[model samples]
Target: MLIERPEANAGTTGREREMKDIIIVGGGYVGLSVAVAVKKAAPHLEIELMEAAPEHVWQKDERASAIIAAAINMLKTLELWDDIKDDAQPINDMIVTDSKTGEPVKPVFLTFADRAATNEPFAYMIPNVSMVRALRQKADELGITIRHGAAVTAFENNGGHAKITLAGGEEIATRLVVACDGVRSRLRYMAGIKTVKFDYGQSGIVTTVAHERPHNGRAEEHFLPAGPFAILPLKGNRSSLVWTERTDDAKRLVESDDMVFEVELERRFGHHLGKLELAGGRRAFPLGLTLSRAFIAPRLALAGDAAHGIHPISGQGLNLGFKDVAALAETIVEADRMGLDIGAMDTLERYQSWRRFDTVRMGMTTDVLNRLFSNDIGPLRVARDFGLGVVDRMPGLKRYFIEEAAGRTMHDKPKLLAGEPL
Candidate 1:
C-alpha cells in the first residue's frame, strides 16, 4: 500500500489533539535513550514510548554497549548516568592489532581515561540490561508514559500531527513521532521512506567471558582476514567480545556446543585473557549498514538505528545513537521554548542536519575499515599495516584517531557533548 506523506494543513492546531508531544516506537537502546533524553530536556512535554514487546528486553539483549564519554555526558545531563554508572566498565586504554600474519599492524594507546585530559573517562562498557533497567527506573520517576505491549498498528500523518492507531484499537495523536526502532523500523516503512542498505556478508558473534586474568581495563581490537575481533573490557576478570566471522561460520559457531565453541573463540581471543569461560549466552547479529534516504519529514523524524546502522569494527554504533539523542533533544527543547511546534520541519531539520552526516560518515568509515581489514590481499595488507605503524609513531595523529573514536568531536555538537549543555 502506498502511504501518503502529506505536508501540514494550514492552521493545524499543534496541541489541540489527543496526542502526546512525542510518540517513540521502539524501546531498544535508541528508543529508550531518546525518550529519556527528550523528556529530561522538556519535562512538561508529554512523551510516550511504546514498545511492542511485553516487557523490556533486558534479558534478550545481552549485547554490551560502549558508552563513550560524550554519550555518558548526555545521560548525565538527563540524570540517567548515575543510575547505571556502577554497572558500567570504564575503558582506560585500548589496543588495536593485526593478528593474521604474525606481523603487528598499527597499535596505539587510547587515553580516554581522563577524557583526553578533559577530566572525564573516554568511554564505559555497559550491558543492554543495565541501561534498560536504569532508563525504566528513571522514566517511572519522571512520569513519562512507558507503554509496553502497545504497538502502533496504523498511522496517519499530516505534518502538524500524527494520528496513530494502537494494536489494542486505541487511537492517539501526537505532534511529533520519532522512530528509534531498529534497522527494520516499521514506522520508517510506513512513512514511505526509502533506505540504502548493503550487507557486509558477515555476522557478529557476541558473548561475555569470565577469565582468570584481570583485563586491567585494556580493550583489544584484532583485525583478521575474516573480520574484526574486539575484546572490550568488562567488570573484573571478564571481557565482552564481538567476533565477526563469515556468515556460515557464524551460524556454525552459534549452533556449536560450548566446548567446540570455546576453541574457535580462543583462537581469535589470545591466551592473555586466560582460559575463557563463557559468562553469557552466545548470540549472533548480521552485520550491515543501512542509511535512510531522509531523516525528517515535518511531523516525523528518525533517530538511532532507524536512521543508520554501522559496522561494529570501531564500536561506535551505540555512541552514534546517543549522539542522535543529544541532537534531537536539544533541537526539540530549543524549538519548544520559542513556542514553535517542536515537530515543525524547520525544528526537525536541525536534528536531521545535525545527525545525518555523522551517521553516514561513520557508516562509510566502518564499512571501509571492515573491507580493508577483512581481506587477504597481500599488497593491501602491507599498505594497511604500514599505515597503522605510521599512525602509531605519530603522537598527534594517534590522539586524533583516539578522540574521534571517543565521540568527542562529532559533526553535530550537542551542548552536553561539548560540555556546555548541562
Candidate 2:
C-alpha cells in the first residue's frame, strides 16, 4: 500500500510519498528493462521510475541501435520482441573494410554471416523510438509507476533506506535506487562515484538515408582514418549511417548547407548503393570513454552509462547496458528470495562482481580498436588489414567470434538473456 503524506493535497510544500521497494532513476532502455525484469520476477515489490523528460519526448528520438541476439532474447522473454519485431531489420551478414574517405576502391577484408546454432541472425537494427514505445507499453501493463518530469535532485542513503528529493521539491523514500542515467549522471556524482574518462577527439555523425538500391540485410563497416563508418541495414531501401570524423570537421559538416553535407556524405558512402537521399535529420555526438569507479555505493547501484560508457566502435554500447539489466535484476530477485536486504552492500556487491569484469573487458577492447583503426599509419594499416583477411579465411575462428558477438559464450548468463523467464 502507498503511504500518502497528510499534506499531499496542499500546494504549499512538496508532496511526500510512501516508501517504495525499489526506485529506478532515468527512463532510458536500461531503466525500463530493469523495471520490467524486476516486476516479472517479483510482483510484490513496489517499483517506481523517475524520468527528467516529459512523456512525449521519447517519441521524438530518431536514432537506431544494434540489438544483439542475447538482448533480442531478453525482449522476447518480456513479450516485447513480437511487438517490435516487424519493424526490426535483421543483419544477415557483415563486411569490414579499410580505406580512406575518398578512396575509389574499398576492398572487403573481413566477412561474417549469421550461422549460430539457433539459426537466428547475430543482431537486429531497431529504431530507438519504437523500442522505447514497446517497453513503455509493457511497463504500463505490469502496473509499474512511471513519473515523467520527476527528476531526482538529491538523495541520501540512510541505514535502512534512501530519502530522495525531486527537482519539484517533492520527497520520496525507497529501499534502493538504481541509476540508469546517461554518461553524465548527476546522481552518480551526488553519490561520490568517480569515473575514468577521456575524450577521443572525434565525433560520430548519425543519420538515415534512402538509396536507390536495397541493402539486402547486409551491414558494412569502413575503417577510415578518422574512425569507423558503419552502414547498418534498415527496412526497405534505407540504411542508417554512423559516420565518424574529427570533432572540428564533424561540427562543420553538420552545420553546413544540405548540399555540402550530402556531398561530404557521398564521398565517404561511395556509389555502390546507387543514389542516396537524406531520409531524416542528422546529428553528431562527441566520442568518449567513461567508466565509473564503483558500480554500487550503500543503497544505490549504477547501471548502463552511469556505470560504464565505452567507445561505439563495435556498436555494443546498448547491448552492454542490457547485460547490466539482466545481471542486476537477477541479483536483486535472488537476494530478495533469500530474505536478505536487497539494498545492502553485500547484496549489491554480487551485481558489481558479476558485471565489472565484463564491462572492463569490452571497454578496453573498444578502446584498443578505436586507437588501432582510427589512423592512417601505413605499416599499421597494412598489418591490421592482413590480420582481418586472415580471420575471414578461418571459418572456425569466424564462428567463434560470431557466437561471442551473439552473447552465447556466457555459461553463467542470467535467465532472461538465455530466453527464459526471470
Which candidate's lDDT is highest? Answer: 2
Q: Which sections of candidate 1 miss by over 4 Å?
A: 1-17, 101-115
Q: What overall lDDT, based on C-alpha atoms, would model 2 receive against the true structure? A: 0.91
- For 1-422, candidate 1 gives per-residue lDDT tens digits of 11222333333344333547789988877788777776776788889888888873566777778888878877777677788888899888877777672342334322332245475557889988888888888888888787888887776786556777778677777788888878898888888889999998999999999999898888888888889888898878888999999899999999999999988887777677668899999988999989998998757889888888889998888888878877888888788777777877878888888888778888889989999999888999779888877777778777777677777767647887765653
TM-score of 2: 0.96
Candidate 1: lDDT of 81?
A: 76
Local accuracy of candidate 2 as per-residue lDDT tens digits, 298-358: 9899999999888888999999999999999999998888778888899999999999989
TM-score of each: 0.91, 0.96
lDDT of each model, Cα atoms only? 0.79, 0.91
Q: Model 2, 406: alpha-carbon shift in Å?
A: 1.0
